[model samples]
Each structure stands twice: as structure tokens, then as C-alpha cells.
Target: MVAQRVAVRPEEIRRHNLSRLLRSIHQHGELTRAELTATMGLNRSTIGALVSDLVALGLVTEYVPSGRDRAGRPSHVVAPRADGPYVLAVDLAVERIVTAAVGLGGTVHERRVTTIEGADRLPRAVVDQLAADAEWLAERLPGSQGPVGVGVSIPGTVRRRDGFVDHAPNLNWRAVPFGELLADRMPRRLDVQVGNDADLGAVAEHQRGAAVGCEHLIYLNGSVGVGGGIIADGGQLHGVGGYAGEIGHMTVNPDGPPCHCGSTGCIETYIGEHALLRAAGVTDQHGPQAIAAVFEAAAAGEQRAVDGVHTVAIWLGRSLANLVNCFNPQVIVVGGSLAEVVRLDRVSVETELDRRAMAAARAGVKVLLPGLDQDSALIGAAELAFGTLLASPDSMVASLTTT
Candidate 1:
């Protein structure tokens, strides 16, 4: 028997086209009608109609450049509206939570940050803080009752299917339905999309930051703990249980340090904030500033600080070699606390990686700082918040379905 043929519905086609067009504009920041037509393989009329539809919905704006008038043909440029629909993005690090109202097309409209204290670090307290921040951001949105979506970046393992956080040792959170809890706090039962912070950072970098155009990349994020996100073959490598990229827990030393996860000598134990500080002989200082000061001291050739940085660089390179051998990524982006570590002792780290990594796998890998600086995860959260909107922009006009 022959396979039956069922054509795609016209409405489905329209939704797909609109989704692609909007995403293209979002990715490139701006594009001309002719470029959209060429890139999308759609006719000029179709691109024009889609752009017009998006402009009508206030999701985007199109304008022709004045100087092009001399050429007698000026293609209109399509861009995400600066005042378009927005979403709430939360970056939940171990010590702080950064929240922002991020508009469509990757613009941050308003942001509020709070340091996590002993009591506030608990699940409920975190939820309360996020809920309050959401309310605050909602009040400032443009002509809206709520945001398009909410994206949270957690410094832990998350089961993305249901937004379940399996384990976040740094946050002392375990077996929590964090996504569900945050969703319950929303006014209209808006669903919350939660992801591992490092993973989200990789997404942001792969799309527009350091790893742009690279098919394979790894993002190593250092905070109070280490986390990683891997993009393999242009897609995130999420294993069977969403714990695939937990490289921080990978044991690099069998008898070095005790990790919060009850593991000995995990990579995070060596390169994370606390580890770096302890190595630098700093006792009373904390936060990113203290970490930066350690690097400054190392650069200034302070004996203890220099020794600490060199030690950390060795471990960083060894761990990176392991990843390069396994994934053969084209780019490895060092972010958060580790960014300074890489910047300070790049030569030592490169030497270690060259010694350990297989020649073939090591050939094309480029280790670099995050292109978006400190905002990779935050911007990535914005991308997660926009997922629903990009998938079916029509949902913006209709009431967005709640999960």
C-alpha cells in the first residue's frame, strides 16, 4: 500500500511563515524585504504580507531608508518594535537573582536585582521574590496585563519537560517543581520555562553571542558553582533526563576538595567562586568584586593570588580538554567567575589543553569570553521567554494559552 498524502493546512502555513519571519528579524536585528524574501525562499509579495501582518500586530515595525531614494528603489527594513510585547526573565544564581522585563527583539526594558540571603534562598522565598518582581515588571509593560512569558535560569539541573528541578546543590534545592510554583504565582496562570543557567547561556551565545555560526559549542559558567551548556551539531545536547551538561559535577580530582553535592573534587569545586577565593587567600571578601580583586592581585603579581590563578588555570584547562575530546566543539565560551580566570592565565590553560586534548579534536576549538559579557544567561532567559511567541505569534493576538 502507498502512503497517504495529507497536505498542510493554509492556516498552518501562515503560522509557520509568520514564525520564521519574526524569528529571522529577531536573529538578525533587522532585515530588508528583499533579504527576507531571499533568505526565506518566499516571494516578495509573501514577505511583504507577513511583514505587514506583524506590523499590524505591533510585534514589529518596517521603514524604508531615506538615502536609498536616490537609487529609485528602496527596500523596506523590518525590525522588532522597540515597544513590542515583552517577557519576564529571571537569572537565579546562587547569591543573586536578576529579573528583567525583556521586550521582543532582545531589548531589556526594565530590570531589578536582589541578593539572596539565608531565608530568601529557600524555594518559597525565591518564588515570592520572583512573583513580586514579576508584578513590578508587569506594571511597567506597554499596554499589557502580563508578559508574553517568563523564563528562569537556575544554577542546577532541570527536567525541562515539566520544569522540575532535579538537583541544584549550590542553591540547596532538590526535587522541586520550581517551574510549577512560579507559574502558580502568575496572575493568569502563565507557564514558566526554567532551564539550567549554563545551558541558557549556551543558547544565547550560539544564537547571537560568541558562538554565533558555530555548529558545536560549550558554555562553561562559573558562579558559586560551575555549570555548562553544550550545543552539539547546532542543537542543545539534553540527555535522557536533562542532566547531560552537568559538567560541573564531573570529577576532575579524586581527592582534592569536598563539593556541596557531596562529591570530592568536582570541577566546580576547583573553579567556582568559593574555590577561587579560598585559593587566593581571601577570607572576608565575597561576590564578583572579590573575585575580580583576586584576578587584579594575580595580574599585579601578588604571590598568593598569582599562585592561586595558576592552579585554577591548570584545572580549567584539564577539564576543558576532557570536554574537547568528548564534544569536539568549535567554540568554548568561559563565563561568569571563570571568565577572569581564563583572561588572567590563558597561556597556562592553553598549554594544559594542548597537552591533554587529542590533536584532531583540539584543532578548531576556540576558547573565548562570552560575547554578551555578563548578560549571556539573562539574555538567554529572554530567548526562552520568547519561545512561545516565536512559535506561534498569533497567540499574541489571541490570549496566550497557559500551561
Candidate 2:
């Protein structure tokens, strides 16, 4: 023992480098021992020790069969442990709670959905449903390990510092201590995290779907309400109070319909699901089904349908144009149910961006349809959980070990 070099901040550097190494492995998937050493620029001994520790913690596993080019001898590949730790993602939509169990690799293993009544009891009901769903997922995790954390994606502005809901018009929640309530409702052993739904969706798209490798991005959500999420430098821009991506409330038209936020003519006022239905003169059906029917009719070339969708498209374009001017994101991703229609008519949306967005803002900005489609929010929930584990692995481990 040569006194371990008597380093002052060696452990800090080691932890940071370990995190970087883990991120590299996660981003690249399977990597051999030598490949990791070369990519991370860590000495062989250091890399080997860290890899061994990761394996012991079940964060990584060895892959024997090599799926590489010119593989003569079977070299061992280290990869994220798919069966080691799990993440629970919950998408709390306006009318439903979409819950999914995902492994460390960001693959969804199981899913369930519960409807919300949108009344005063909405919060309690949603919490209860989630608790039940968590239990259900816990029962079928398919491994000896437990869920590392619970990540919730909701349709609102989350106060990042305190994990409270600043305002969720659809949920009628105002300044609610969302994270605290949800955590209290949880089994006390699980680590709980909350995020803006649109932000999480952006993470899903950026990490595992269409926006991969695209750093500056704007993700638009078309559901009961319209929302937006922004990603810069491979991370979400949560703003000063975590209310960064509330583009739906952007003033698209001064004389538009009244929004739930007590403002008139917000973007959501003219292009939200309800607004689209009303614009299309649809009243019989409700929720996403009605919106879907409107899109279907538009696809079939119905005049009213075409007009409704076009109007919505124009409003959406204007809202996005504002975002383009503000952030100048490299790509604009349209997601959710309405994104289906937008994908079918990408030319129109792109044309709007070109026409309204500034020259420089529109230069490299490409309008992309939803990558994961309807599964975006679900997968986003999974990504949310993965992020939680990355932040606090020990708390996550404790949470998983309970029950």
C-alpha cells in the first residue's frame, strides 16, 4: 500500500468519471471491456474496477455472444442490466393515467391505464389509481429486483424546486403539492419524481426516438391541451421555476376563445382538442375519441374536417413559430394523437414554419412527426424513471428493496 497517493478530491473525480463512463455505456449500448476503456479514456485497471462495481450493483451485465463485425473469438460485452432494476413511468393525462413498468434499458415491460373523472376528487382518485397500478407493476416486475423509482409525467407546469404543480388547467390543479402528495401516497419505500409531461415526451423522443443526436429541439404535445417541451445541449430546459415549456398558453390569437388559464386567445384556446372539436362543430362525443374522429374525417377529405384541421394547423404553426423565434431549436417534434394528422400532412406544417418563422430560425429547423406515436408519453414516463435513478441511485435502491 503506497498510501493511496494521499489524494484530496480523488473520490469526487472518480464518481464524476464513473457517471460519465456509465452514461457512455448507456448511450452506446453493448461495449467490450477494452472498448469502454478506450472510449472513457480511463486506465484499464480503473475501468475494470468500475465495471466490476457496476456489475455487482446490477446496473450492468456481461454479454458473452458478440454481435459485432469480424467476431472470431467471443469477446465479452458489457451492457446495461435489463433485468436488474426497473422504472415505473406514469403519464397523468387530463382524463387518464397511463402507467408502465420499464427496465433500465428504457424498454416498457408492462402497462395499464385508468380513467379520471376530472372532478374535485380527481387528485385523490389519480393517486389511488397510481398506487394500485404501482402495486400491479410491482407484482409482475419479472425479476428479483424492484423498481428503482417512480417517474410521473403530468400535463402541467411543475415547480422544479419544490415539485409542485404551478398550474394544470386540464387537471384543475393550482399550486398543488403534486410531488409531495404522490410521494406520500406511494409505498414510502419508492423514490418518487415528477416532471412536466411535454418535457418527458421530449426526453423520450430525444433519447430513444426521432430526435436522437439532435441537441436543440422543441417538442409539441397535442392532446386535450397543447403544450411544448424544449431540449438544449442534451438536457431539458426547465426554466427558472420549471415552467419553461408552457407554449400552449402562448398568445396565438388575441381574439381567440377563452383558455382555462383565465386568459383569452391562448394557443390552446384555438387549437386544443376541445377547440378543434368545437371548430369542427362536433359535440356528441368527448375526449380524444372525438378528436380522433375529426382527424379521420380530415383524412377522408371532408370539407368541415379539412377546414377544422387546417385552422388548427395554422394555430399550431403560429404557436410553433413563436417557439422557433425564441429558442431557435434545431428540430421541432409534433407528438400525441393530433400529431398523427400532422404527420400525414407534414408539408403543410413545415410550410407554415417556413412562412412565419424567421429566416435564421427556419433555416435548419425540421418539423418532425411524433416518433413513438401514441407510445411517446408511456415511453417518456420510463425515461423519467431512468433519470431519477441516475440522480439518486441509493434512494432508488432503498425504495426498490421495500416489500
Candidate 3:
């Protein structure tokens, strides 16, 4: 006798389709079951069954109308439950530690910032302060759901694969297990993600700021030491070891000055805050004031001041031109505390790039200032936390069919 083949029920396929349909709806926000079915090309019964499962899982809620949908009772709409869970984002900068509680809706519920003068303070003190702030916020959440994850943005090269901080020169840290340390300290069970500050800033820009939809973008972070984040083809290109965007060390001048990285004349030798201060003869004062001093002196037509800005701009422009030739980016965004001082209104740098970069690469590439300024990294860190909860597999599976 020939082997008999078993027939598959239409309901089985419908159930599977229903699950996927609901996930799509949840991803885009509230939608009617009919809209879900139409979008997913599934039958009405499948959507209904899937929605029912979501409702039971407490992952979705129904929006009931008072009356009528074209000669019948109004159809109910479904939306992902807003009260599900939360994530905590910690932005660890050289001078500050900022903590924020974020949700699936990308809303920041609470935030706190603690300042530090130097790296001499205990690392445990910083962690304790951050944890305490998170506790204060957790008390204020509407429901019992705790934070699902924690994301930290550090101002240095972070090896995400092993969750280690290779170096944070600004903060004077080395080989620190930053993520694991925070995870062990927090009261709630949390999955931690550590990333470079500039990289996270680029992510925020891509998601909601200036770099939105651009295929090739470079975010050159002008800070204590210059670093950058690159995005190509709509995704952040974190190289093989997740350290691809370390553009600060790119040599701008081979024999100019010594850099902390033990290199002579790196781009940061000219573009870094220290270089600008020294060029302007205001190395005594630290932080944002030093940058302002350079601008003020330049505005006054002082030779040292004028020379400082011109030299920095020239080096910055040259480095940018080289990057343009290398990456062929659609846009380059300049961000940091100093980005606010000077407007890159006209490109003395673009002239350099025009001379160096390929015609096509130079044609439409825009190098502009970041809209968010220094806050970009903090905001990006919070976004990272917010996305962590929304992008979870459980959240996706729960959105469609609950069972």
C-alpha cells in the first residue's frame, strides 16, 4: 500500500499568520483586526484568535468604540499594552553619570545626573549613585513591572562581544567590566549593553535626529579626544570586534605633536579640546570654558585665538575630507560641547575635500552640526534602553498570539 499524506488544516496556517500579523500591528501601534488581516493577508478568524491570545497575555488591550461600523457594531482596535516593562539607560561621561528610565514608547520617565571633577573618585561610588537614582525612579513607576534591561554609553572604546572597556582615556579607566559591575549592583535583574558614546549618539541621530534615513553617515565627536561613529546602508557598522569607528587616532599630521595614544600628530592633536586650549594659551582652565576662550579670543581678532581656530578648522577639514574620500558618506555630523561655539556655515574644510575627495563623493555630502549638542549621547543611551524592551523576542511573540 502507498503511504498516505496527511492534510494540513487552514486554521493552523491562520493561527501562525495571525501571530505575525499582530506583531506587525503592535510594531506600528494600534490597528483594527481587519487592518491587521489585510496587512498580513490572513483570514479574519486567524487575526481574532491571535488577538484573543494577546489580550489574555496582557500584552495587548482592546479599544472599544461607542457605536457603528458601516451598518454594524463598531470594530474593536488593538494596541500593545503601555504598562508592560521599562529599561534604564546610564550615560557615563568623564564629568558626569546620567541615568534615565525609558519605556517601549520611547518615553523617559525619570533622569538624574551626578558630576565628578576627576577620576580619583571610587568607581563603586559612581555605581552606587546611579543605582540609587534608578531606585528612586522605580518607586515612581505606575505598576509593578521592573526594568528589563540596562544600557550604558561610555566615552571610549567598548568591546561589546566580551562586555569589557578596553580604554576610556577621558575617564582614566582601563579594562573595566563596566556592564557586569552595574548588572551585579542593580536590584532588578537586567541585561546590560555597553557601547561607545559616539556610536550611541549616531544611533539616536539615525533613529530620530539629523541622520535619519541617510545611507552613509559619519558622526565626528569633537570632545576631550576626537572619536566618531559611522553608519552605512541604514545600520551602524560596528566592525568585526565592534571597534571600527575609532577615527580619532587617524594621523592628521605625522610630526606635529605627541598624543595620549603615543602617536605623533593624530587628528585629535589639533581637534581635541586640549589642543585648542593650548593653541589659544588657556590650558589652565578645563572643560567647556576652554573652548569658549578660544572662540572669544578669535572673535577679538587676537592672533593666538585666530591661529587656534584656523589651525583646528584646517586640520578638522583635512581629516573630514579624507573621511569623505574613504566612506563617501551622504552626511557628516559634528557634535560635542564645542560644536555650539562655532558655526560651520561655510566650508573652508569643504574646499579641502573638494580638492581631495572624488567628484561624486564631494557633490552632495553635507557636513553639518548636530542638533542635540552634547545631550546626544545621553538621549541615545536612553533610546538604547527603550529599544531593548521593544525589540525583545518575547515582546514580538506576545504581540501577536499570546499562547
Candidate 4:
């Protein structure tokens, strides 16, 4: 018995190798067998066997390279199957719900955006809308294999163990078992996963967006509220309870306004959508459009708008300075409404960084917008939906096929 435990099983090794190959193709779109061998550090024969297995599983296909070298035969290229597996990606934002069918290889096939009018009535309605949206998108795939799972991006704190929305101040959600609720509404067989919007956005940007190869990065998602998704040493910076990247709640001002999270002078109150509006002296108007209007006014040389934007820029810079000192990220990708803020006032943000951050840390960091644009969270949710499938490609494909 002691001797038996010492040796690893051959089948386990095969599974691990197969998953590695699939993940590579998923991330890089396609690769030749030689390239796979080099990138994965596996032998040529093993790479061929793994590619064949994936081909048989309908997860990937092999194609001859269009251009051939006269010196020798061209290596076959492996790419994800067009009609292969896909997942439902739901982005629950401050003003709208965006849904998409994201397939293998990070391809977004189709999408739908629904605007939210009433926040108070969202609890039951939101889940129903998500369920219907998933089904609706799945129906339109047209000869493609069905979704493997459902990934929802909510603007709040989520419980990883059970997809519970612990708190979503913007959506007015609290203690909701969001995963189970959506799963109950959809097909019982489909796996439903929920995560924080900012966290998912970070994952998307890291996987295919602005900071693709960088191991250390910070993605600040500023919508109705400001939240952060930090990647340290090539992984998420999830704290003890999976709530580490709450940048909005960080104390940016000691004598600042109150935040929805029951804190005074939090970063969110200073840089969030409302913060921009108040600075511009806009009243009885709200959400993204109003915020954009303020920036437009500033662009038009309105004094109030200019001052308001300048004030917000000072705080934004200071908040970024705090992040730079602690995390020392390689790149800071700003998305959502804040992306616009950075576009209009990047110099001011950098000015604060110059004044507040250490010279060494600030020098290496680059501030950029989301590479995937406004769809980072939705794409990240799609990545989440594909997690189980990517873990064990062969077995997961089999289950998906039979079901």
C-alpha cells in the first residue's frame, strides 16, 4: 500500500497534459504541433497524440498550413472547432445587462444588451432576465454545440463556494444565493457560476486584453462604483474571504463624503459616476450618460465641469498612487466610465502619481484602457463559464456531448 501511493498514475498525467494543450490553443487561437511542443515543453510525439485526442473530442481541429516551405513539409496547425463548445457570459452592470455566447478561443459569437429602468424591482427580475437571455442566446447558435456552463458577472461581493451575492450596493442586492437562483431557472444540467464584475474584468484583460503577457497588473473598473481586480504573480489577489480587491472602499479621503458601503471618504465616493456628476454640478440626472455629459462639458470649456473633472482627477491620481505603492503592478488598465475620465484627464492622473507614488514603482507602470473595450467583464464571464471544460478537456467534452 505504501509503495502504491508513491507512484503517480499514467492516466492522471495524460489528463494534465491534455488540459495544458487545450488551454494553450484556447488562449493563442491556434498553434502548430512544433510550437505546442516548444511552448508546453512536451515532446513532439506527445503533442501529436494530445492534438489527435482533442480532435476526436470535437474540441479542436487540425488544418494544413496554407503557405508551405520548399525545404520540408509544413506542420499541421490546431485550432478550436467552429461548432464546438461555448458558454453563456452575462455582464450585470449599473444600467444594463449584456449577454453573449463566447466560444472556445475567446471568440464572442453574438451579444445582446438590455437596459435596466427600475433598480428596486431587480432582485427576482434580474435572475429571470439572465436565465431567459442565456436560453435566448443558446437558441440562436445554429448547429453549434450547446453551452457548457453559465457565468454571471455581478457588480458586488460574491461567495466563491456557492455563487452567493453577499452584497451589491449598486443593484441593491444583499445575501442573495445568485448562483442557485439562476441555476434553478435554467436547465438543471448546466453549471452556473457567479463572480464580481471587476474581478472578472481583470481576468479578461489579463487573458486577452491590455496586460496579456504581464504577470503583475491591476484592472480598475469604475462604473456606478469603483472596484478593482488585481493580478499578482500571475494569479488573482483574492483575500481570505475572496474580497481582496475592493479598491473603492479604500480610504482616499479622511474628510470625504459617505459611501454606500457605510464608509466616509472612500475612493468610490470620489471617483464613481456620482462623483463626476456632483463635480460637474449636474442634478436630477444620473448614470453613464450624465457622466459622459459632464466630460463633454469639460471638453467644451465649461468652468464648472472643468473644475469638477480636475477635482476627480486629483483623487483618482491619489488612489492610483496608493495602489502603485502596495501592489507595484506592471500595468494599470482602467475600464468602464473611468476609462473616459482617464482619456479626458490622463495628465492630471499622472500628475498625482508623480507627486504621491515612489519613483521606482511609478516608472514601470503603464496606464491604459481595456483592450477588450467595454466587454471585458462579459468576456471574462465567458472565460469563467469555460473553466470546467478547460480543466479536463476530454471528460468535459464527453459529458457535454452526451448531455
- For residues 1-403, write the lDDT of model 3, one tens digit per residue: 9989998798666455545654465345578777787887767886787778766655577887655445676668887666656678887776677888765434566787777766433466767777797888788885835676678888888988645888877777787887777778875446677889889888777665687778789888877877888999888889988888888888867987998777788888888888877776775687766677667768788888777776667667777888888998999888874463336313556566677777888897998777566667766776665453344434544443432
Clashing pairs in 1: none
Candidates sorted on lDDT, descending: 4, 1, 2, 3
Q: Could you give candidate 1's per-residue lDDT for residues 146-198 as a string of tens digits? A: 57788999999999887899899988999999998888888664658999999
Ten contiguous residues minimizing lDDT sum, candidate 1: 394-403
lDDT of 2 at 266: 86
TM-score for each model: 0.95, 0.90, 0.78, 0.95
> What TM-score, to 2 decimals, does candidate 3 have?
0.78
lDDT of each: 0.88, 0.78, 0.72, 0.89
Model 2 residue 319 CA deviation in Å: 1.9
> How high is the lDDT of residue 227 in model 3?
82
Q: Model 2 has how many clashing residue pairs? A: 1
Q: Write the per-residue lDDT of candidate 4 for residues 1-403, one digit (tens) a residue.
A: 4656567798999999999999999999899887998999989998998899999998899998878453587888999998888899999887999988888899988888998868523767988787778778878887888888999998999987789988988888889998988889887668999989889999999999999998999999998989999999999998988877999999867788988887899999999989988888887899767887888998898999888888888888999999999999999999998888888889999999899999999999999899999999998898888999999988787776676
| Candidate 3 residue spans exceeding 4 A from truth | 1-84, 120-122, 142-144, 292-307, 341-346, 386-388, 393-403
User: In candidate 4, residue 152 scores what lDDT?
Assistant: 91
Candidate 4 TM-score versus the reference: 0.95
Per-residue lDDT of candidate 2, residues 1-403 (tens digit): 5666656598767666666666666656678888888878889899888777677677889877745775577656888877777778888888777888877666677889876664633677777888899899888875747676788888888875556888888888888887888889876666677888888889888987789899999889978888888998888898777888888888866887889988988888877888788777887878877877888898898988787787777777777788899999988888876586575565666678778999987897888887777667677767666765665444445455555
The number of clashing residue pairs in each candidate reads 0, 1, 0, 0
